[model samples]
Target chain A: MSSLFNDDSLKSIAEAYEKYEKELVPEWLKKLPERMEEFNTLSWIPVKRIYTPLDIKDHDYMEKLGFPGEYPFTRGIHATMYRARLWTMRMFSGFGGPEETNQRLLFLIKHGETGLSLAFDYPTLIGIDPDDPMAEGEVGIVGVSVPTIIDMDIIFRNIDMSTVTTNMTINPPAPVLLSFYVAVAESKGVPRHKIGGTTQNDPLKEFIAQKSYVFPPEPAVKVAMDLIEWSIKNIPKWNPISISGYHIREAGSTAVQELAFTIADGIEYVRQLTARGLDVDEFAPRLSFFWDSHINFFEEIAKFRAARRMWAKIMRDWFGARKKRSLWMRFHTQTAGVSLMAQQPWINIVRTAIEALAAVLGGTQSLHTNSFDEPFRVPSEFAAKIALRTQQIIAYETGVVDTIDPCGGSYFVEWLTDEIEERAWKYIDRIERMGGMLEAVKKGFPQREIAEASYRFQQEVDAGKRVIVGVNMFVEEEEEDIRKVPLLEFNQEEIEERQKQRVKRIRSERDKARWSTALSNLKRAASRGENIMPYVLEAVKAKATIGEIMGALKEVYGVYVEPPIY
Target chain B: MSSLQSISEEIKAKRPLKVLVAKLGIDGHDRGAKVIARALKDAGFEVVYTGIRQTPEQVVMSAIQEDVDVIGISILSGAHIHHVKKLMEKLKEIGADDIPVVVGGTIPLVDIEPLKKMGVKEVFLPGSSLKTIIETVRRLAIEKREKEKLLT
Candidate 1:
């Protein structure tokens, strides 16, 4: 491959850079010494004062960064990008009972939200009914509680499942949740092929970051892959797994660790499918991703750009995926929740705005700008609208989306993009040598790495090496008391009681013989190493609660116990 | 030496304060719990972490078996009200309520006073400095140790 610039041109640029650094830098430093003793990114990647073409002189425009929507998609996956259609504004929302969450979904759609992302409460997330002793006070505390087909039907009662794409943020028992959704859609006259959405079925990341694994590693992954295989053959439009880095970053890994570990997880999923003698291109097109757009402006943009380029190469070279769609890395980005500060709570709006802009510039297919009041409680109605408006202002007023890949050729961005990609590849290779993400996670490699990074970042903040505005720097006096903020509060007991009653009603009214047969069939299929999606759907349609299905599977797969580690 | 080091040495003069750091209920967000656990351990205290998804019964049992001076519950699930109530009841049932308990995470300020009234020693919200957490834990540990001596 030939270089983008001729040698003579590159040599002259290098000469000019050297002359300016040698002569001008010394003069400038004498007048105004650098503020910090050392300059580094949040991930501790040492950044130079300035970048020049000489920094990326080895780059070839064609090989490194082709036009948008092409192989090695360094720019973006869509040629027209946001100029043709704006990114989806999907605010991940859920609270109270299924009816309440359904109301919120309608409200967001009325306010111009392009997509839906549902957050399940702790019990539903872990595949337990509200009445479970383990679920006492946690029924609908953090998110919406949906433990059966009845709740699922109520949650999507009015919404058109065929038009608006929904993303369910659940793992481990993802197949069960998907079954509930599919059964609900089918009841509404929506065919399987027409029901388009995504289930965050990536279980590998659960063991690494989210800590929400149900079954042991081997069977946990087997169940997740069952969803992917079933979805590919049954529901063509559905995205089975969103290989996610958002939870990884929230659990406190650096941007590079998020990139490397997430892609490695994606590779493992692809391998699982192919090991079953399935074609890579058959399912690769539907493999999507989720990322955390953090506060670091340039680094977050570069991370997104690098992620697309890296996945394209991996799919083509390693997996031999021939189709362009199979190689494309489509992802939804959420502004970092961990970055929001409790002090000067209103300033969180500005933080989220800045982070949302970075996601747009990074070329995300969908975005979720967090509410300013997230640090205090679940977002009030006022806060959710503000978050939605932030995305609107960026799309309509900012004019950042007029052109595609706005930061494509900036010297700093390109260099950082390459730097992040190279470092991420090293981590991926190391995990591959350890026999992929499952083995590495079993040995607690990524978990330990994240713990170390989180501690180091915390130390930096505590020591004042890092500035978090109201927290460490600027030292706000008499910060606003968070209680005064109009926060959303839930009647936990009432919600739990209502949900448990619904579960009981559904179980008692349904045909007992069908429910029993459905559950037994599910357990038999799971035990026999067969795909359990059809059985789960049958159970869900037969009015079996999530807890019953998971219980039946538990007898076969067993529960995962996390080893103690700091 | 720094004041933190001096405090660590002072605490070590008698014995390393055993602290049991735990995550109660089904919440999987353990970043805050792990960070606080490591910080306490680094401050010359012994920290026994009960991984994630432990019920109140398991935590109380661990505290009594470990014989820790302080029990720090890190929760972000908004289920703090339920978990803390159960935890306090369990500790009282076992007559181990003397161990100082500190709660931390994305706790609403409105809930702090209620939590404190339920026998919590301190409520550490976000933006709480490690200095404050460490010093408070040490003071609580000293109080618990004194009570133990009196009882014996």
Candidate 2:
């Protein structure tokens, strides 16, 4: 592995860099001083004024970066990235009810959306029926509520499940939701092999960051693994678990935290699956990831590159994965939702565009650009269209896709990529020593770290160290005013009542004996330490609600109570 | 820093007001709530956080049992109006309505007025600074303590 620069040339470059920083910078600073005392990335990584060949003299290009579509996929996971295929412009759409979100999905597809990303409401996410007391006023509010297969039927009534891949953002009840999708597809005569989509069956992130977890970590992961193992046999094209970092970042972890914690979570998943005697190559290729493309342009790009490269090494060296596809790190990226500010909401369009560009440059497989009105409410149709158009404009107009790994060889990008990869590996190693993410999460290690980081970031913004235009920096005189921005109106009572009645009617109309027997079988399977996917599928076919199947499992697994931290 | 110092002094002058910081609904976006709770604690208030998925009834019961001077409910699920209404009703039913309730989250401006009319003492939306939140909660806690003293 020869270095990119020879020793003689490198020494010359190094001496030149030293003279420039020591002598040239002092003279330049005497005449015109720099703006800030210290410049850093949003994650607080110190940044230098400029990067040069000397900065990356030790790097071996063929060894470190390699070519796109090769092992150690630092350049990218694919050779002809956007030139051959564009990233899926999937808008995370859902609100009011299943029918309403279905309309929005169709609208997006009509407007050139390449894939569908569904967002379930709170009750559905935590495995509660709309009629449950805990679901009061929350039904169909944030996202589509699918308590049973009936609602799932309405959501994809005419849409061909085989044509477009749907990404459901449900966590704890992921198995039940996947069963409903399978049942719906079978009812529509689409075979199990042809059914395609991704169920975000990741429960570790639910416990660690999302806080929507239902059962305790061990049993929750068991249920998630059940879905993944079953899907490997049945739905060959489906990605069972999108091990996600989007929620972690949205929960206020720094960029490196998002990378390290998410990869740690993925490593835990692989260990859990391999413990069950399944071959690593069987499921590793179908495994996918999700990340938050934050506003820190170069740092975010480097983070993406680092994530791909790190995951490739982990799979190859740690897991002994020999398949080329198993070494590929394919992931979906979403522009940071937490970056959107309520004040001067229109400027959020610019923020989204910039973040979307970073995702494109980072070689994401699929991307979701957050709507500008996210901070105000569920995005209005007008705002969501603009968000989709933001991706379209970048793809067609920017000429960024004309080449693969456009920012692959830059000195700063390469240096930052290595820096982030090294920092993230240290975290992963620490978590590995602490007996992986589950044990670390149980000890509240990651949670406390995230809380500290979030608090410090808030303090920085408050002290005017970080400039969030229209938020803490650019003073908007008419602050707290979102009147002019059109908002999506929701009739909470009507939607809640409609969802409650749907769940109620499904319970009464279905074959009661079949539903009860299926639920009992599911409970027995869960208790006997058997795979719960077939039993869950039986329950879904019998018209059992998500709450009932999950409730049966909960009786065996018990509910997990989050200990207060912060 | 000066305002924070004054707020701390005022709390110290009093018996150190206890506040309930809670995620009333099922929404798990508690970054703002936790940050605000830490800020209030730093500002010399005793904060009892009811972690995520606490129903309004549970929150009201905790507020009454803890005898908090203020209740801060964070909801990002757009169900703030629904939960706050039930919370206020529960508080009124339990005769704990005097405990000032402050709501915060990604609440739209249209809902703010209704939430305030529903007896929410203050509504903090997105972009609300920690400084503003700390000062507002302090003022509300003092007002509630004074009203309780008058009644006693």
Candidate 3:
């Protein structure tokens, strides 16, 4: 790779920078005091007062960051980018029962949402029915609860499955949810290949951050791969696994850790698929990523750019991917929910808007902007609308979408991209040395790293080193009245009661013989180490409840107990 | 040397405060709970974390077995109202009701009063500083100790 600047030009720029820091900075400090004693990005990367060509003197335009949609796609995966078609506005919507979540979905679509992102309740997320005693007090609390295929039907009622793409944010039981969705789509006469969407079927993240794993790591990964293998043959348009770093970042990893661990997880998935005798290009194209657009604007954008370039290189060079589409690091981004504040909750709107803008400039294919009030509770209808509008404003009014990779060539951006890429590659190399992400996770590498990062961040906030507006710095003498903000209210007892009764009714009404047979077949397939998707699809069609299907698999696979790490 | 001796004596004289940081129900979000556990440990308290996806019964049993001074419940799944109510019931049933419970997470302002009425001593929302949480837990532990003395 050739350097962008010649050795003489680099030396001149370096001398100029030193002169500016020594002579100009000292002279200016006499008249104006510096804001902070030390300035750093959120990831603890030291930030210079000003960036110049000296910062990126070693950068090569072609080798480091090629043109948009080209090899090692640092600029972007798409040539036209948003200039041709804006990124998908997929606002996450779910609360109460299926009916209520369905209503919210319709509301978002009516207000110009380009795609749908479903959030399941805790019970459904962990692959249990609402009626389970373990699921008591949790049914339909966080998101929509789908205890059976009946509930799935109700959730997608009257919606054209063929026209819209959906993303379901569930893991561990993602196969079960995917099965239910496929059954629903089939019932609606939508062909399997025509129905497009993504299931967050990444279970490695479950152990590392999300903590929603059912079986132990080895078996859990097998089930996740089952979906990927099934999707390649069955649902061509569906993304089987959205290897997510969003939750990892939300669980408090740094941007580099998020990028490194997520890409590592993606590599693990590809390794598993290809090991199954499937070609890499066949499954790699559908493998998508999910990232968090955090508070730091430039750092977040650079993280995305670096991630795309790294994944493209990994696919082409390491994995020997032949197709261009296989090398594209297509991703969906959600603005950091942890960045939202409960105190002066409205300020979260600004935070979310800024984060969304970073995601757009960073070249995300799809974006979900969290509502300002999300830190307190599920977003109210009004708040959800505002979040969707935030994305729309960035797309239509900002004029950023008019250009491709708008921040591709800035000195600071290029430097930050290189810095983040180098740092992330170090972590990936470390994980690879541990054998792979699965072994790294079993050894609690990422878990411990994330925990330490989280604690350190809290310490920074507590010690006032990091000034969180309305949290550690700005004082509100009197609490603002939040009564005016409309809150989403749902009767928990009633929702649970109705869900329980529905589950019972489905069990009683379904063909009992077929249900038992389908469940038995699922268990057999699960124990035999065969692909469980076909059996899961059969069980869903048989109206076997989520609990029953998961129960059968649990008998064979057993449950996972995460090793305690502090 | 005398001051250091006094500090050592102070540490030896009192039973170190023990707290159980737990996540109940199907909520897998434990970043806050884990952070609180570490912070309390740094503040000279013995913190026992129950990890994630723990049931209310399991949490109460752990509290009894650990003989914790306080129980801190961190829930972000918006299931606090249901989980906290069940937890309070379990604690009472186990006769550990004197062990004060401090709830934290994405708790709504509207639900705060209800949770407090249901015996949640303090509710910490998203922007709550670790200092505030540590101070509140310490104060609650002291109150609980006094209440146990009165009952005895």
Candidate 4:
């Protein structure tokens, strides 16, 4: 058997692949891989040499891929992919106080960033102010610490709210922060429909990774749906929810587990809406996803391609979305934060570029490439520019985006895409058997799966089977690791001083009676299971501090403690 | 060099060693700490991992409550000067001044000399190999165990 499978046969096989390479690959290509196969993340499936009619045997270009903006959306979402308009280049920016974050946002816009992606500090994420005792030295430490409508106003200072598509990376406090944004927009005479942006109202990922939950999973989902329903009717151009696998992957989930958990979450959301007597088409179109482009280049590309096809199938055959837009998966991709290492930190730039390319090939609407020094510290101006410029070079010079779904018909791509679909569907079916994502998360199915994947990867590291260059191998002897750099330290005195002014100003001013009424209304809304967005917006309009509104609501919902684990 | 011999001698004599792996302050990057935890655990020393962002008070309290033989605090956030200084001060107040602390994370070579004078047994920064971290923990655990036996 070994002799039969020798290079004699394999060499012939390799030659056979290149025999018809001119037809499959562009005629200008001199060399094309014949026996070289493509592999997906799971590392089992092998893609064929060339894709032809036989590969997508049942595929109808119109019915499957169609034109841009058409059904199935295997191509781009818009009628033109960068012909009419380029993809939104939103750099995820926010650090320090509202004023400092405002400066960063202006700097990003000045440097060709098309939109905003705000990263709030932990205090704001947990629905507290910088003045909260738990805030400690963490106030304005990692990201911008937004505490109230005042902070929001100062953060967006001179930036025009009408044109900028600002994405807020807040989950547990999304409803509250979104309310602040709406009030600010209304204050600026910007129509709700004209305000195009997204709130990452993805609370499910919070439970598994992120660990940024305010309420338990039960109420978290309810609040997420609250945003979904509210955004569809009120903030028409806004995406109510961005179902994310970014944090899930960042938390150490494998590619298939990320896909399974993410889609399962989306399915549960749709089911919840359906149970509420809302039609699938009514809110499904506004649903968006955020994915992570990991270091596994081709695998990441295949994952994205598989995701589009899988979502389309789910919308059509499973949930039944009548509209084309409803089936389309419009998602933003960020380079894997987990992949960035502190050792030889500059190498992270190379890693991010490769990952970002996967995102582009995988058909991302917007992308955020991780900074080279991000793992060491929050990105300085020098690092962030390189990250942004990387995407610019790829988009302008790379020619990979010239065709629709450029990797669409490669045998390796199709095979790998199918393999990913197969593996992911297995996990997806398992989640379904366990009663979907919500119950699976409660039972710790996804977490356990991620833990297992993380364990195996660790074993591989220990055995030196997989090399992480600077980490596991290729280390330099007597080479000094740069520990201290001029990091952007949060000014503690300034924070304390600012907190005092904010607390005093809020207590002294504002319509006391109206604020009290809104708080009472918010409490009632939370208690009665009414959509809390409208009432939250009412509180924001009254200039109710984020703490006051959140505290009033927390009294009703109650605080939660995570399960103790080893 | 003689310290390594005495520690190994105690270990071969079947003496149990205790090592407490902890985090001081709000730095939550635990990959290195957790890996060290498992490595120490697998290396046959009793280990305790203090979870998440903790105050120095919590660290000192855990060290006492766990009756740890040696304490290792891993801090990634650049608040180490304030946190480690506070922790050392609290240790003196609690009369656990002789309790050894192996510092980890972001500790540059220049900071290491100062840290050693302030009573840190060793400083394991980013570039240190996993094997070296395990070996140091083992040696420290043994040395602490042997010293306690001498007192008894």
Candidate with best DockQ: 1
Residue-level lDDT tens digits of model 2 in B40-130: 8998889999889898889989998998999999999988888999999999999999899998889888888899899998998788889
Interface RMSD of each: 1.0, 0.8, 1.1, 3.7
Model 4 deviation from native, Cα RMSD in Å: 6.1
Could you give candidate 4's per-residue lDDT for residues A1-566 as a string of tens digits?
Answer: 11213446556756666666746565534475433334324333444544544454444456545666765566667777766566778888877778888998999899899989998776677787667665666666567778788889899889999998899998878988999898888889999889889999998887776667777888888988888898899898999889999877866677877887898888999999888889998888899999999988877888887787778889988998898889889999999887876667678789999999889988899999988766545788888989999899888999877776787666566656667778899988998998988998898788667655664566556666556778779765544554443344556557746865786687679889998899999999999999998999998888887777778877877765554332
lDDT of 1 by residue, A1-566 (tens): 85777889998988888999999999999999999978988778999989988888889889989999887888999988999999999999999899989999999999999999999999988888889999999998789999998888999988999888999999987988998899889999998899988999989899898987889999999999999999999999999999999999999999999999999999999999999999999999999999999999999999999999999999999999999999999999999999998888888999999999999999999999999888877798889999999999999999999999899999999999999999999999999999999999899999999999999999999999989988998877786655567888667789899998988898889999999999999989998999999999999999899899999999999999998799
What TM-score does model 1 achieve against the real structure?
0.98
- Candidate 3 lDDT by residue in tens digits, A1-566: 76788999888989988999999999999999899988988788888789898888777778888889898899899888988888999988898899999999999989999999998888888889888888888888788999888898999987899999999998878888999999999989999879899999999999999887898899999999999999989999999999999999999999989999999998888888989999998998999999999999999999999999999999999999999999999999999999998878788899999999999999999999999888877898899999999998998888999988889879899889999999999999999999999999999999999999999999999999998998888868566645556778888889999999999999889998998899998998898999999999999999998888888988999899875567
TM-score of each predicted structure versus truth: 0.98, 0.98, 0.97, 0.86
Model 2 Cα lDDT, one tens digit per residue, A387-432: 9999999999999999988898899999999899888999999999
Off by over 4 Å in 1: B1-11
lDDT of all predictions: 0.92, 0.90, 0.90, 0.77
lDDT for residue A5 in candidate 2, whole number 0-100: 84
Please give me the DockQ of candidate 3 compared with the native complex: 0.73
Badly placed stretches (over 4 Å) of model 3 are: A1-3, B1-12, B147-152
Worst 10-residue lDDT window for candidate 1 chain B reads B3-12
| lDDT of residue A284 for candidate 2 | 98
Ranking by DockQ: 1, 2, 3, 4
